[model samples]
Target: MASATNTKIVSSPLLVLLLFSLYTSSAEETGTTLTSSTEEKNVFVLDNYGARGDGEHDDTQALAKAWNAACSSSRPASSLLVPKGNTYLLKPVTLSGPCKSSITFNVKGTLLAPPSRSDWTQDTIRHWIMFQGVSDLTVTGGGTVDGNGEIWWKNSCKTNEALPCTEAPTALTFHQCDNLKVDNLRILNSQQIHLSVEDCANVRVSRLSITAPGTSPNTDGIHVTRSTDVQVRDCAIKTGDDCLSIEDGTRNLHVTKVVCGPGHGISIGSLGDDDSRAEVSGVTIDSVQLYGTTNGARIKTWQGGSGYAKDIVFQNIVMDNVQNPIIIDQSYCDSAKPCEDQESSAVEISNIVFKNIRGTTASKDAIKLSCSQNAPCSDIALENIELKLEGGDGDPESTCQNAKWRKSGNVVPSPCKGSN
Candidate 1:
């Protein structure tokens, strides 16, 4: 959900595929300019006339009008634009794209969501703004998409709830989508996931501030599932739970240049329980910063589940005031004791590597590995991981056990042998 942008690299893998028609300005990209003076561009301005965020107000109609007007014949090329203005209160809105036409939401104003769940109707039970089957889509600009999450995060309805807390209240959700780019936006505060891109391929998220308070329940920054070829880079995150989480059916993912705090840093999965029908593989994370977080980098799996995680790497990370910098918890659940005992792990963690991570810790141990006794984590390598904990005597009780851990002794990542 976040990233930082340096000068664009000259030739990337997808340059040929990039039409270059979207941004027509020549090389010299200077300071911020309001309008892109190129052809085939659409523009829409949101003023206080119709769009207003008056507490319990619903500005859904105004937003829809703007979207419809932007997509109308004036911008027939489907160049959806966003003009600058103050935050316009709005209900959940859907921004979808067709296969042939690429859409750009040049965020100009903050899109504030409603404060009350009862303000929304039941039929509208999806993300705050759901994007589905979008192709070659780009969401960029210097504005924010504030979910107004304080009220809803603590009340999200789970499957086992008596009365549903709220339904489909994510900040932004994409399902079964392809070729999306989310850049330079502040996507924060959500009932559930801040931004979710599921079942999509070839997606990139950069230069964003995706966050929620650490006490907020289920306020994950970015949750990707059943997806491939995804990259999240160059952003700061402060959230309730996992800053970045990759679930099942995910492969070939990369994360870099991130700053995290007050949350679980980067996580693989609590994979299992038939919740998802896939596995995660071929992931790499580098140049990250973790602060005041629950766990720095983690790979979690259910106690009794199925699947396999392979070919992952974590490199060049900075830790500050974090509890557990490196962790792999194959036994994951909210309950105190293990519930169901399956034959083997529905998901097996293997072939992973951690490289060049340095930082300080506030907890007793720096790293903890807790894989299943039956299906152990294997073929793992941790090289050049330096850690320091200020108050500890270094030799603490066992908090890590199952997985294989090996690394340079500068800052030892403790094994998962002890309980909290």
Candidate 2:
């Protein structure tokens, strides 16, 4: 009887099928599925890993665990999901990976940062959320990251001189990542810069709404440095600092269909500071709208720095109430101490074109090209440019120092010439 029972159990195909079905069902319930070939693809939910999503508790450890699981999975495609209708408060965390396969961080809920500056220690917490060395990644879904930066802003030396000055953490920073895509996200009230892309390649960012108070100090909307093949499109950014600041070692960058206001307008540099070398080339900015900005279409390099900025183009720009609508200031000094007069800046500026720019300037000098004397600007061109001053009569004025350029087609304010 025992032998017959064993034989029946061993030969039961229905039992084997039932066990297989249960395994598959279990896998599906755990946000993973098994294919016919028995390979698993994962969708790791944060809640499953002990994330409260209550907006009060720290979910940093929970998020880290989910990321590690998804990143270590053997799946060809995996996703770490922050599900909708919840807020997850996160402390400073670095999500680092060269994962086994392509991974997506699907954020469908709000992520909140610590409210007070005292909650962050400077050396250890320079960025609220950092994604490093990740490739083939997509961060999407209509969500928000709130930096809760009111206290930090109030403590800033720029806002209050009585407070001691300190560096604030960036809201999101991507370092050494490749083939990354970020879209449909809103980053708000950052302690400092809202988004920073550093040493990355093949990055595409679109449809981002980044905002901070106009009085918020050093709150740049997007800061890209030492990156390549980047495309930023269809973004609306209003912040205290530059809407887009492109730093050294960046190439083949394209910015289009952007709207900027209550911020310093898109800038190529404040490069070569403290005598460092800088290089930027192959940049194009088109179809942009700027309103109530400090500047529009600017390239600024410090006096004592060494580098080159070339092959840049700004076209089809419309500005309203912008100061320094078109500018290239070689002697840009923001320090309280006066910049010493020098013969020239070592940074070479060349091959820059501003075309089809129509704007109203808050300042009388709509276009100011103050290039270095020793290394004068060359091959600069202004075509179809028209600018008028806001709340003032007559055509706007342009000033050029040590800059040589060719002009064609409807330049409203005539450009000044350098004695070459």
Candidate 3:
């Protein structure tokens, strides 16, 4: 409707029921289901930009000649302005739609993205803004898309500082798009992945404000790889590493009331060790809020991994100064030692659930289940989970576990007995 806020990717429940029935149906039924009959497509106008987007120069060919004259406007168009205080130094200009053809980008100006590479290519597609195979696309207002990335996060490690050394790429990607809608943009400083939903479908990302620096290593604040039926709601992520990472061919996802912090909190699979791809099923991360984080809710599966991380759910999350508030690492290794999996498709972290979570762990283990004694972790659930670690009486050579930690009528969380 007229209040669909800003977006990043995945949203199209028939374009939110045709913009809420065309904003309460009037004005001749919102001009018979809008698609721009000048209903609103106000393209760049900050005195035709001489300098203002504050990223300086290369005004991206004058905002890609005003977005190719407003998505080739020939009457029927509906929303594409960026007018606030004006700081529009754009480059990658693409807005494809013909299917249901519903576009909206009010975004009160400050839409910047010009770090070069010929201002982000088109046919070869390098990112900044791209949505091919679009359907009812949306990117709402209260603008800002500053991807000036301080020269790629100060050379994001030229020699491998934990993998994510992008020179300039991925700042808002919507690959293989459909029914997508990215909302309420603020999305700042990006060298790599600040919002990405690949191979999307019926997606929705709402009330967003995805940021960068925390040292800006991989950026990564909302990265759903090989996607399908996604939803990330009420967001406000602080980056520099995994603040919501669902990878390895993801499936029907949902992450709600998010407010992640300082990075690395809400993850599911580093998954890539030849991450077999396809089979990360029905997922959910609810009511999240983590500050000074470092793995508050994680499910990392890998050791030379394959597929199947099914039916996951992490409920009502809240952790402060976390260091591993609640974890499930299926022998995930990064080569300093444990790397030997000749053949083991073992990813099955099944029917997982963690409801009513409450936390405060500072340097490790409030709960850690390092599965895979030979692929052992199935039907896990922990309702009413509470965590409290960060003091001296907790790490007596820690290595917590719960082999069959099920709870609902009996409760059990103590049988991991392997310490360092």
Candidate 4:
């Protein structure tokens, strides 16, 4: 997929190889470890810290004590292990650190959240398990994190109109943690967002399986905001909201080799909301497969805001029966009340590239770019795109408004004006 060129397309195998080399080079240069290892790490077992390991008993105190000891240890590399073959119930807890050294929080057993909001006695229950201010941390083990969120879902206003809307707790959060690695974990049935990384740098999340029911409300698989130099690779996500949501103040984010379905596809923003400035740049999402999703490769922003979202690329993507396979909605409004028509200003969107995208769309509108009049989108390039209606008589259609774009190769139902 060459920009501004009519050259023949490269084969898939060669493209994948080149991408792999680039990823590896970046990994090496940044010193981001892709895997978690327990060897050479001093072990601190939870059972030794007075935890009963019973499903009904509260293990929050024991976990706190264990974390304190681990953080205070003089060892260079420490490990906090929750042994396998048991289920431990945890209340809302925050594990903060400016720890002694590098640490690995290994979860080999099932960590179950409180079943309902009534079980939470904290002042506020916005986050179930939060790790804050830690550096050089790795959380991995082939275990399960069960949010037990059915009761919350049933009471959510999004699910039932009778209930007033309220906030639900995210399952896991990493705030201000640098050099973090999270891999080989199963996160299931979260109340809201499954995992969030906020205000962090140099993070790598890979080989994770995150899932929730298709009808569950607001269960985004991974949400990254105010972070930089992050890489997400080799994950499978099925949730109600975006599989990967990249938010404001994020730069140098790369996502590759992900499988997403039964959810909103990979998205950048819903940014610049409430008349605020938002900045996001240098994002590359490549080699992803989406099936039965609401939207694929989307960039959305609210009106009446400032700043810019630019230098993004979505390449080598395949979609199966997806709706809105490629879209840029600059006037996004998720409120229950209708937004006023035609705002004056918006987030400036520029330098977007979509390449090697072949898909079957469930909706008739395969590509929709609805940009703002005041701050129109610019430098949008579409290359080697071929999208068809999944089960219809005619080819899928496209609509473009207030976007300056160009097409190089094989775009079906071309969206740009004067596109051949």
Q: Top model by TM-score, which number?
A: 4
lDDT value for model 1: 0.69
The candidate scoring highest on lDDT is 4
What's the alpha carbon RMSD for model 2? 16.2
Candidate 4's displacement at residue 248, Å, is 0.7
- How many pairs of residues collide in each model? 22, 0, 22, 0
Residue runs of model 4 more than 4 Å from their true location after superposition: 1-41, 121-123, 417-420
Q: lDDT per model, in order?
A: 0.69, 0.84, 0.66, 0.86
Give the residue spans of candidate 1 off by over 4 A: 1-41, 46-57, 69-77, 154-168, 274-277, 335-338, 392-400, 405-420
Per-residue CA lDDT of model 4 for 244-330, tens digit only, reads 999999999999888888899999998988889999999999888888999999999998878999999998888888998999999
Question: Ranking by TM-score, best first?
Answer: 4, 2, 1, 3
Q: What's the C-alpha lDDT at position 336 in model 1?
A: 34
lDDT of 1 by residue, 93-193 (tens): 78554534556667755778878787667777557888776676777776678888777755654333554654547788888778888887778787778
Better of 3 and 4 by TM-score: 4
Give a tens-digit lDDT track for model 3, residues 1-420.
111112122232234334433432321111122233333544334334343456565565555554445555565544555566667666665555453336565666576776655555445334676666566667766567877776666665633467553345777787777777887667887767777888888889877777787777667888888888898887777887887788888888988877778888788877746554436889988767788777888888775565678788887676766887678887677554567764355666778887766656786446777777656677877666556565645641225443565655211133244531
Span of ten consecutive residues with least summed lDDT in model 3: 1-10
The candidate with the higher lDDT, 1 or 4, is 4
